[model samples]
Target chain A: MEVSGGAPKSKVKVGIPRALHFYRYFPFWKKLLEELGAEIVLSTPTSKKIVEEGVQMGFGELCIPMKVFYGHVLHLIENHPDLDYLFVPRYVAEDKDAYFCPKFLSLPDVIRILPNVPKMLNFEVNVKEFPISQSVIELGKQLGVGQSRALESYKTAKEYFKEYQDFLRKGVPVNHALRLVQRDLPFTVPKKKSKGDIKFLLLGHGYNVCDTYINLDFQKKLRDQGIEVITIENLPESLFKVPVIVNKRLRNYWRHEEEIMQAIRYYLTKGRDEIDGVIFLISFACGPDSLISELIMRDMKVVGIPFLDIIMDEHSGEAGLLTRIESFTEMIRRKKRKLEMDAKKKVKSKIKSEV
Target chain B: MVQVSDKTDGSKAEKEAFLGIDVGSVSCKFVLIDIDGNLLTHVFLRNRGSPIDSVKDGMAKLKEAVQENEELQSYTIKACGTTGSARYLTKAIVGGDLAKTEIIAHAVATQSMYPNVRTILEIGGQDSKIIILRDGIIIDFAMNSVCAAGTGSFLDHQASRLGIAIEEFGDYAVKSNNPLSIAGRCTVFAESDMIHKQNAGHSREDIIAGLCDSLVRNYLNNITKGKDLDEPVVFQGGVSYNQGIVEAFERHLGCKVEVPKYNVLMGALGMAILVRDHYIDNETETLFRGLDVSEQEFKTSTFNCGDCPNNCEIVQVKMPSDENKVIARWGSRCGKWEVF
Candidate 1:
């Protein structure tokens, strides 16, 4: 809430629509903008009306998340006409080999053409072309901030972002970690205590999994059933550093896909004994997910791990999803019981032979 | 089967039986089974958009059947389970001991009948599903509830349009030697294609057979896509009664498709079995309100809560005996008004 840069008491308002990468990188942007003395304006959370408006504005065949993003942007534009600028970042690639999905890379361009939109403070965040620090500096320059002031604010935002990532690595949920970051509270690593129940690894895009309305409160449903769910964002950064091994003849260059694959590999290689099953959540008609899910399914089959793939869209009903999750958890629990019984029987036989 | 004694003494011993009810959008089904999982009696009725009335009528018929049979009279209902689209509403109405989705109920019943069943093709009135099993465990499944081209209701509509009874429609399909090819992607397109074939002077038998083949094709293309379907497949639900569709599945898969005697009542039977298992494992008393629930008066109403932007329409059901007391409330996103 503190406006650091001293130009005017009422700083320039920057609208940040809550969609897509908002869940992942909002803290960094918010901190940097505030440090550069800009007031942040966020759109309302996703709802039925927002989605309906988005559907009317968007053409058919776009993914639900993308449509929802458009709706959020429209909401911000319509509600906050007094906003000075909207921050729409173009994220082309995160790593050298892995590029973002086409939707993410072209999001700024897609929103630029929408009618009745306010001025946009667009900057490139591609590592190869324009690094994040450079993008932040350019964003500051657009707001008439000095280069030294922008550099200092960017360094402070980077430190906060790193702290937020550390919280995520410790298995805290993204939303909860964001609150802690906003409150400027120290991150306390959540202890991993085994409750002697089935543990499932839920893998999906940050937007799809974190958005309650989009995923139909999937995490709460699982937790209510006493099933422990660990999401891909909960995995340590070191896990993502491991190389993803697809087929020698094929390559998957999507950054999100690579992150999910690395998490799956980590669970399969080291956390197999701790985890009971894996649930791969994907949006309907997602091209990247279609291929990544097939590869993951094949790999899971080879590793002999229990897996469930749930595809969601606007038409996804909650009853069907609950049924599938119930059956899956029951199956895992039964398998775990059988394994324990077998172990007990083996010990009983050894004691009888010794006697 | 156990025989009833001739003695009419009131002190005669009573056996335990579990009741299962399936309140679907199109039909309501009821099943009664003994503690040993033996089927006692079952009833299937059309829903007609009133689940409460259908459940009451089904329960009344079930009570009459139990009273008419001497052997069934010896058994007392110990527990009740509900499944289907209206499972939650039916569970609250009947005070069910167990409630589960149709998928789990159908899978459990099929597994009980054929212990080694690896795949199950169930086509109900409004939806169709393919359940994949391995080692008596369900691992994967898919349901095509969005489309009507592959479900039983579409076939019924087509049968009515052709002025043929749904029961006899299958017989005509079986008599056809060479079935005509019809598009099966969408229901509207398929209907137009069927009419066009009729105008082209194709025999009714071949067209019906072609319609059956089209439905089977749609089912396989949509529900079973990317699935590894193994042998010992069991096809059930209301659609399984149609021999033409059964033949189409067998011919398409190049394997035998087994249809149990009580195929349409599998969901109810599965719930009965599950309730029996739950009772035995937990050693708990039954939650069944009794046969008198058929005569009870209940009311349901909905109100949209404006507490948040979600504007969730919360449903509240008033108990029959006490109109002032709301028995159940749901449909809230934040679980603020949920009471059951």
Candidate 2:
């Protein structure tokens, strides 16, 4: 395979699975690994057989994403044996503004339980507590890369990562005229507009939106109605400004909640002008979404912004949803019409007074 | 009132109805029964959006059915009962009735249908549970909701992946003789295994049948573990319609599994029957807010309840037409918000 920069082959190779947080942070890992003169091999989109082997390896009760990660690991061991070290970074939290669930924090420990594999290398990174230089040195030594080489690669990788991230931070142009702003991207994508169309913002965790069957064609129904749906996953992590004092003390804290809140706060401040309404799609038993959604919706209601809270579970119903969506949409449409009519009337009156 | 002894009389009372609502994570069912314990109207709708909206629509459908039936309108509803995940929210919406667990409702309904029901295997849209019964009483039960493979949702997901409608899953199951050994312990493994089987040149039908088999196997291993499952086993819930699963259970258990006529609505039916029995002795006002309640807006909010360290966040849904009333309260981790 031809390397991007035409660099010579490296002695050490690392395997990364393009799943879960990998979907969110592949570019960062790629640049970092390359700068450190290490070969990076990422598994393909999880195929059926790989997922099966993964399931067999990762024992009982692990979530699908974790299983997918395990599947990728199994694929690496089976297909590619040239790896010097299998690097699985141990990420607990990014900052006070960003945190991951206990599931992610314990992933390395869980993966270690699998039968047998190459030398496992893990680097713990948490900006709030750990020093980046120390973590990089530890990671380098584990991978058989000397301190000098590892330190230089770390600096280069961090710089390149920041540069690439900047591109994502600012809005990207979808076409010549339209811009796809990530910060206000709704969870649900809108249907193609004809003449007049309504738009709605859908907020929730990525897992909920990505799991289509569980959510029951939430996007399809909205598209059927020619409504534009927005979600949080579309937003760039950089565009989202962390809230002041965005720390929590809950034992079971949802890592994504703060980011969701940050994105929502940005959208509520700016999205109110661009979007017609917002809908918070929360899970039935998820404690964090319940609290965060309530807090956000309460604030929205006070501002006279129309917001709807949808709690989804395994038994989501069709007729009830249709009726509710119809009602909520009808309310929003009527309100918009009323506002337009009132504005038109005021303009006509002003024209008559000038005459 | 006919002067008769309670034991002698079948206690046939007219002009009073009972409402039973099952608010499942995947679906919501409403059943209205007359004092005679006859099923008058039933509303089964998919909970595609919100439980509150779905339940309200189900209530509206029930109202329409009642309006068309003269016998249903003649009697006032004596009581209302709810079951399932959203039972508390449903109870608050319907008001003033017994709120029972899904296990109790399922058992009660199954027992009423087949007096000799030994094992009750119920798989709904998103979750699955096995209730072992001895002499018409639940001895031990196990349920798993966090994962998808052990439930009907897994089938729905795999069906969509195969580009087959959920209704057609059973027909494909019948056609496949050489089924692949697909894993169904969790959604991830099952999905991965399905892809691998498909890639390995297995027909979709064979893979689907394999999946059906694995689902049944997982259910047996996780739910019916160490239980004395015997003859006359009954299958209930939406998953029972999947012929693949039903046949799978029969094939695995080596016995015919009986599915009742009202298997899908059995829980709702059971709750309605319970309500009828609760109000059999005395006349009481039903907590049902009438048919017009469907048109009213419900304002829902959640606040961290400062009462304890659990901070047990309480979700409050205030019904319209009441200035100083909170119709429903839920979302308490400690069951504190479940106000009857």
Candidate 3:
């Protein structure tokens, strides 16, 4: 939807990188920028050149997020420099006492170190602590909209943002998260659904799970297994359960660790009666995920259930992944038979002993 | 009933026993702690080349000890808990009530012994970790898995190279009044510095002491970086038993660190305690198959799934019985393994 009654759209285009936090927060940005009378340009998927350029522009030690963000910005500047500036939101906790990881807080600073990037624009949104409305208003004013006009645009854009959220949460199997943000309801996009012979759960960092281009063959391989794949977004949020032991370790973070634990717990406990097996999808170098995956393994052992830990990297080896999945599915099939046989044996033994 | 076992003082009614196994890469420790946390029998064996054989041998010794003492034979096998890297393998060998991560087991065991401990510095055979606790809750911590500069395995490697048994390493370090300089940032650098110091004619004792100092320094720099290490520190893990390292820690931090009595078998102890806690609240039969489980044969293989970009590599362990059963499955990041 195009914004109307704007004092002519700003000639300069704004660049948005379709990476990291882009999948979730981009719509708010796209709608807000458009309403503020600014044009928007989002960078494409991360590739060899993008990653290489990102590494060059940022501190050598900068984490993957910063590296990927730099690459996206570099792509925009080299390809579409007509954009007035690059928008990189520095989301800080609204309450001074509340804090984020040093990495998230320092992201904008890392971007500043890059060479020949667009004029970077940023605004802090402490979602729970700060009134998001005020932050959006101030950002609108900074983009040259009058106070009243900014407020009106912010209200209109806020409606669009809610509509966008309701759209994506529907989990229509379309690969593009951006399109989901455009409509008010779950769009009947052609989904890559397979009436699978095997059903598997996909667990991982939100960025890796939601971004299709990062993990190229995610849907196709599942379709091959006729495996019905389930992700965190598909499940009811209320069904997530956090193990009591994990609560202490997750106290500082914004329920991210809790959400992961909850997602796994929900699937394992509730889906056990429905699904065939589970597969944990994790990033190669993610720290918190490595630990969480270990915890899940132990949980599986205790419950006498079977599971798998599938780690993904930028250079994900398809051959390696295929072999692991094949074996795991085989193992699951074998275990199901064994469990059924054991149940039958118990009944036979009880009847014979009674006689 | 045969005479009650020494591990169990007829002080508690309804005789029940727990098998605790801590299988590390370098060493495998097995202990039978009674319901009251009293040590009944314990075995510490080098992991050598095979974890399966070590567990079998340990279980055999436990059987012999129980049988030899007529009174102890009355106490039945109740439940078991396994910890460490090879705990999964050990669990497969000895079917039991629960399996837990080494971290949770260690933390639980330490908390039982040092309830007031604010920080736990656990440097095990292959890895090192720092666990912080406040209000009896784990607050924040870090584990060093990638590097071996501050781990017990590195110390063992250096001791063997210097032609000294690992047992003598602590004594030699303690004897040195002036430790020679040794780089402990990495194994290669530390070995080179030790060789240089030896060629320069430094005493073995001094060099060993220097190595201990370097290990302590590396631990402080890497594992304890930016951590709020508070007082009432409890140092446990296999490395905690090394007096030389303990002394070096004292000198470095200028604080007295308390080492729990069962430092080497703390993970197993923690698992046992968790089992006891979980069982006391419920009435259920222990799934433990007794000593005969050690005689079973098991095989492991790996395969990959091409279903998604996250190609999960799954590890499967097979057990042979009248029925060939696929006993355990793991190694998918998604719930793929669980669904299977």
Q: Which is the leading candidate under TM-score?
A: 1
lDDT of 1 by residue, A258-332 (tens): 889999997677877778889888988799998988888877877778888888888788777877787778767
State the local distance difference test value for candidate 2: 0.69
Give per-residue CA lDDT, model 2, range B96-133, as digits (tens): 47766676678778888788887889999877777666
Better of 1 and 3 by TM-score: 1
Candidate 1: which pairs clash?
Answer: none
Q: Rank the candidate models, highest DockQ first.
A: 1, 3, 2
lDDT of each: 0.84, 0.69, 0.70
Deviation in Å, model 2, residue B56 alpha carbon: 1.0
Candidate 1 residue runs with Cα over 4 Å from true position: A1-8, A189-196, A341-355, B1-13
Considering every candidate listed, which one attains the maximal lDDT?
1
Instruction: Considering the two chains of model 2, state its CAPRI-style docking category.
Output: incorrect
Worst lDDT 10-window in candidate 2 chain B: B1-10
lDDT of 1: 0.84
Candidate 3 lDDT tens digits, B1-340:
2222233455543577677788876788777777897777777777765777788777776677776776566665567778777766678667767766666677778988888888889898888878766656554455663576868888888889899888878999999989977888898899999999999999999998998899999999977765567878889887887788899888888889899889888888887886776667665666665776557676767888666644667877777673657777766655467343
Comparing candidate 2 with candidate 3, which one achieves the higher lDDT? 3
What is the DockQ (computed on Cα atoms) for candidate 3? Answer: 0.02
lDDT of 1 at A195: 52
TM-score of chain B of each: 0.94, 0.89, 0.88
Give the per-residue Cα lDDT of candidate 3 at B133: 68
The C-alpha interface RMSD of every prediction is: 2.3, 21.6, 13.7
